[model samples]
Target: MKTILVIEDDIGIQKQLKWSLSEFELVFAQDRQSALTQLRRYEPDVVTLDLGLPPDEANATEGLACLNDILNFNPNCKVIVITGNTDNSHALKAIALGAYDYYQKPIDADVLNVTLNRAFKLAQLEAENRALRSSNVAAQEIIGNSDAMIKACRTVEKIAPTEITTLLLGESGTGKEVFARAIHKQSPRVKKPFVAINCASIPENLLESELFGYERGAFTGANKTTLGKIECANGGTLLLDEIGDMPLSLQAKMLRFLQERVIERIGGRQEIEVDVRVICATHRNLSEMVAEQSFREDLYYRISEITLVIPPLRDRGHDIIVIAKALLHRFNDEFNSKIQGFSDCAMQAMMQHSWPGNIRELQNKLKSAVILADSKQISAEDLGLTAQSSKTATLRMVREQAESQAIRHAHSLASGNLSKTADILGVTRPTLYALIEKYKLLDLRTTESETQQ
Candidate 1:
């Protein structure tokens, strides 16, 4: 049974409530202090707070204070304020102060029971949603249930245990580095160092030294022998972010290191052997660079032994909402704000906006919105997004997206079993096969033998 903390001071009314709310595990408190004690002890999800507690029963002073206390102790707790018919002002004030709902008394058991049940159901739902988000976010710090994201994650799981040279291709701010870290965490070299260096951020003159280190007096700044990123990440992973930005002069040396598994530092003849798994990421098209003779083709092929393409936020469909919600939960805790969720207009705006800057843009918008939001729910205006900025989706586009998402979701639920997926979608097997091929989801299709087994 769910617990409800009842803060009614009147003995006769309390007795009436005890009988009326017999289905719940009720804890009674006549004043603010006792109510807080019962609140801490039971940690009840729902509370019936009478806005007329002793001493100040005529007014709502004590009752309002008690309501604030309960909310402060646990923001998620649902407080249903109880007030006299004439106490309309107090009831409104309580609601404004974060009470879930307000109730007018000459207590109707049936009516209050209905309200309590609704509150309990909502609380349960929010709890479950939080758990689900936590699990997804905790796993490799990757959040999204979209088909594109699922495919990427599954590929990572399959390849993380191996020592393949992985290349992550994505648009800027699409979380390529985050995926690199996820691979490192899942790899057998997880306990070893995971070094990351942005090739684009470092100067061309110093990039070689940064990657392969130098001996004492190798250059003006080289006073002592130093281990480079590759050497430092020995037995672990080295992420070369924006690898497309690497200078052509250094590309040949990099390719040599990949092939030889040894590096000769600047001003040093000794070939120091190093064992490191290289993971490269870039927003630039290395293939075009190779075609343009700007990047070495051999090096590109070496780094891309196993490539994973991260989908842009716009292509991720409902994943935008999933990521936004996860970010909201995080920013709420960071800002200590009671922002419950996004408004309908805000959600529509998010869905419509083309996230050219991707996850980085989303994070910045949400962080700022959480801090500056005037209401409990964030509005489109709060995110600095307008309806005009959103692209108008065609009917065909919407239908296709919905169908793809539904098929992918069902396919996953059935563990790639086409017959089961078809059954779940209330479709024939042949129709399901056609739809899967239409969406280019052949990669997720199960073989006939595997399905039979």
Candidate 2:
């Protein structure tokens, strides 16, 4: 339970508060000195300061002084000033002095509890933001705690120490390069240079030269003998991003280099040996490309000696919120904005969106929102999301969609086991079959038949 420090001088009022706010662990103080002492002891996130204390109970002098003291001690603490019903002037002054809110003399238990709950929530959000800021200083590590992410990270840990040519398979904006850098950071060649080249972004003609370098006379305008990415990262790690986009003509040479650990620069006949760890990443399905005869099968097998598949943001569950908050904190510092956090609508929109562009899209949306947001909280509109449109979806449609998704997820987890799927969904096998049929999940039925076989 959350702790609340109540600084009130009236004995009867304190007893009434204690009885009403029994849900919280209450710390009582009749004066400023004891209030400060209790504050230091409990370090509660929230404090209720009655603007009527022992020495100056008739006036707001001592209570205001205590408010300043509390604020000075812990700036993040939410201090709700308790004042007389007609003392609007002192309440406004207390607010100006950084009090979270004010409660009048006639305090209703229900109303005070509501204010206290809000204060506690705000305090928690601020604390979480501070923690996220501290933890993401480097901003290079992978950020997710989902089972898929945990499993992928464990795989990276196991493979990083070895000199294996690993392949990272994932959708775009899924932080494939980040994982590559993580592997490089964990490996023996961490002190050496780490290089990355996007095969898809570079022209086919220039990609080979970029990877293996070119002699001065190899091509026109070739600056005096330049070292390529492979040679530049001789003793380090080289990330071949979007390797599936590399021209099929160059695949043979890539395969040869991978097999021999050597390369021949353009217009250079002699072979040059290079000691480097190679990591390849692509959003494309290389196996499918290999079957289509576009990507070389040998090269795919060679590079994918070890492969790690990164999970998409949508599948990561609460990690989306964790990542979104981390990004918010980072952008707040970058843009020097005091945007507190996301609004309820903004959070709901985020959770509902599929995140097709993943973290990159999230970062862009947040950066824009932080720069343009006028309010303390980022609303769905500020994030360029339409939470209202989702409300237009009929209740029946929403329920059916949710049910279909749950059944599909449970079916996947159970690996086509009808009984196991039913158990996971907390339904009978017949009910599961009925729902699957109603949802027209033909693939699942086929999988069930295959499993039975």
Candidate 3:
């Protein structure tokens, strides 16, 4: 049964309400101090507050103060304020102060009961939504509290509900597929299939058939009709990994399907429509490839309607430790070990090491450490990482150097288009411009431009 804390000063009315609302587990308090005490004890989900209590029973001062206290204790709790029929100002004030609803005195149990039920239902719905989001985050393999990773998670939250083609650009092992799956999990078509194919992993000869399916008897061993990744993911999402490496010939076919949302299998006559949300991920610089005519310009535009640039692991500060600990816990559970935590040396080593392979490297190192560790606490040696470096550069300087190097890299990859470089660097045009000046990148930009022409 749901708990409701009723705060009423009048003894007779208090008894009346307790007897009337007997279906709920009831706790009653006659004044502000007692009400607050009961609030801490029961932690009720809803409260019925009378806005006229002792010392100021004739006014609403004491009652409003109690309402604020109740909300401060637990903001999610629903509070319904009871007032006199003409006490319009007090009722609205109670609501403004976070009361869920206002009820005039001379209560009708049936009507008030209906309102209370509605509040409980709403709270339940909100709780379920929070649970789903939590599961989705874990499913995406996302674990971090750092502001940079948090911003990336927030971007996932904002774009998860849409059907636009999203492009994820980052170095390898930065969890692009994880973010892609997160988007699919939060979409309306989550119940359908989520199919992913790596364009670079497959040979060019088989890549086309893998994406658009093959008709029966279309090739040497075409004994049966087969559905492609796109068709299999109908009403869901399709993740094209390493899209930059897709063959130039297939890029034209892929571009047509993207433009038309229809595909015709090799040696097939019918144009089959597949309703899949497309997400492309790549470490290779597609924009520069487009400029060099290795990738089609139209295809680049088609795949990157909205792009999410994932910051590398080194840029995420203590997120490295957070992710490592979580992975440690998971590995401990999987391997049936009792490792307590990381040694101080191990933690320091993690913070100092530059994770070139991002989360994948971190996960692999932890897995190997768990297998090798004999003691309860893991040490720096166990994780296959060395102790602190002797270099004298401050962390801030290291970050600036990394940022400068990345900007120069993107400049070369993007052929010095400020907009494309900004997109690749995951910054606004103004911020990229400031970085260019700060890093003395103007000469590099000029070199890139001269080489491009």
Q: Between which residue pairs do clashes occur in model 2?
A: none
Listed per candidate, the RMSD to the true structure in angstroms reads 12.2, 11.1, 20.6
**TM-scores of the models, in the order given:** 0.62, 0.68, 0.58
Worst 10 residues of 1 by lDDT: 387-396
Judge candidate 3 at residue 365 and give its lDDT.
93
**In candidate 3, what are the lDDT values of residues 192-299, reduced to their tens digit?**
889999999999999999999999999999999998889998988999999999999999999989989999987799999878889999999998999999999999
Winner on TM-score between 1 and 2 is 2
**Cα lDDT of model 3 overall?**
0.84
TM-score, model 1 to reference: 0.62
lDDT of 1 by residue, 1-453 (tens): 888999999989889998999899888999999999999999999999998888888888999999889988998899999898574878876775778788897889977988899889768755754564464422447777667777787788788889999999999999998999888888888899999999999999989998999999998978999988899999999999999999999999999999999999998999999999999999999999999999999999999998999999999887787689779989989988878767657878898899989999999999999999998778899999985533324435666789999998898898788889899999999999899889887766655447677
lDDT of each: 0.87, 0.87, 0.84
lDDT by residue for model 2 (12-96), tens: 9999999989899999999999999999999999999999787988889899899999988998899999997495988777775
Model 3 TM-score relative to the real fold: 0.58
What's the lDDT for residue 256 in model 3?
Answer: 89
Task: Report lDDT (Cα) of residue 245, candidate 1.
Answer: 96
